[model samples]
Target: MAALLDSVRAFFAPKNDDAFLIDRENPSDVVARECLLDRAMGVGRRKKSSEALRRNRVPAEGLALVARDTSGHVIGTVRLWHIDAGITPEGNAVPALLLGPLAVDADHAGKGIGGALMRAAILEARKHGHGAILLVGDAPYYERFGFTTEKTATLVMPGPSARERFLALELRDGWLEGAAGVLTASGAKMLEAPLKKAA
Candidate 1:
């Protein structure tokens, strides 16, 4: 029985070097992606400030991405939501993206999938002319990708959050300069609606 259990475990384990393909998330991936997130972040993830921002909204165009393994399982995911950064130095409503809940299946940890997803999300956000991104995450982990607290010092989330973990990355120079006040959802129409129909 012990040998049989070992065989099952070996078969279910993720290979450390498994090849993963990153792609734009489609409607069909919703269920699997949610399952992966639940497995990675637990059911209580909905209570976070980031979730409040993402509620009833859609991710920015081409910014919701997933990483699939060779067998086509959705193993990792990241998304960016449109948000208002209260106001800018010029007194205009500051537009930016809120990145969050970047999750990877526990079995797939340490394979650089999360990093790959971040790079993909940032590159796509820039390509789409987005100016900046905000996320509640570890400074140490996101700093490597250019996120910092310097621009986000005066920014506040709509709900409670750890001040230090709230960081920003500017896709365009000076996007967040002199920006301050509460970060709120953009309420932008879902860009994925057409894609969902096409899928």
Candidate 2:
């Protein structure tokens, strides 16, 4: 039991790598970001309920981020999107951000990259004055960062998601108090390019 306990503790503990640095994601990192996310989350990632909220939408300004190793290769990625995290029972839309698809390269797992990204994103959201943030993920992993299902009890995602896996973190105290309704995409839509001229 002692040996098993120690191993478990080590597994859950954050491990740091001085070689890594968190930075605002650059447009040039798209391919690297996609590969990292695919390796960490697999191809079916786009089918998740959260994808609907992110489809054809852009991440909130300055909230798209990545972690680069000393070689300048993207090893992790996270993006926060604008969402109306449901409405209040009084019928007012509660503005919030939806954090999702946070992924780290398989080779970089357990190096504290995920935690660093999470902390940076939360800080940016607070700096930008977002009221709350929501996500669907394992409670145990996210709980360490102050995410909880408590305030999300009355909220609902647009698609099917496990009740317990839906979680929220209120940046402003009581921001979610009266929040209750279906989540909907509220981010800026992707700008369309001009049609090509016929030859």
Candidate 3:
């Protein structure tokens, strides 16, 4: 993981020749602040208000990543959550990961930082034994990461999101074969097992 992060840092340093680093746990306030201001993205919600910001400060509370510039300024941020799968095709509860809030400062928009953050998240999920991950995003943008609508049809979420926007990626093969049912506390507990010791 260190090597992968080093590569990401190098890739982002060429422009303006600034140094870069990755924060594996919580991102600094600067990064979060800028990300919340990006109107092109849906991150400027109440969920990103000052109260929510304080709530998200705990390290390892969620899988959040941040990239910093030479002066240690936060240039980008992303986060992930473990929530219950809303529907399961086989009646058994489905446990899945949710990826979202991928935000990059306008100055850093064109860089590959967003993609690097996503790749790191997927890699981390697999390392932690997660079966699958889901997201509501543009098909073309997420397709490169193996996320597709075919494996996500049986799943449901509590929102007014478009059906076509729902997508999932099976980190392990056949993970979605019979996965069906609402997420339960037990499922959340199960997913927390791998990270418990890490914490």
- The top-ranked prediction according to TM-score is 2
Clashing pairs in 1: none
Inter-residue clash pairs, candidate 2 = none
| Residue 5 Cα positional deviation in candidate 1, in Å, after optimal superposition | 39
lDDT of the structure predicted as candidate 3: 0.62
Model 2, runs deviating above 4 Å: 1-18
Candidate 2 lDDT over residue span 114-159, tens digit each: 9888887887788789999999999999999899999999889888
In candidate 3, what are the lDDT values of residues 135-166, reduced to their tens digit?
Answer: 77888999998999998776655544666877
Model 2 TM-score (2 dp)? 0.90
Q: What is the C-alpha lDDT of each candidate?
A: 0.84, 0.85, 0.62
Candidate 1: Cα lDDT at 166:
92
Candidate 2 yields a Cα-based lDDT of 0.85
Give me the displacement of residue 149 in model 1, in angstroms.
0.5
Q: Name the candidate, 2 or 3, with the larger lDDT value.
A: 2
Quote each prediction's TM-score: 0.85, 0.90, 0.71
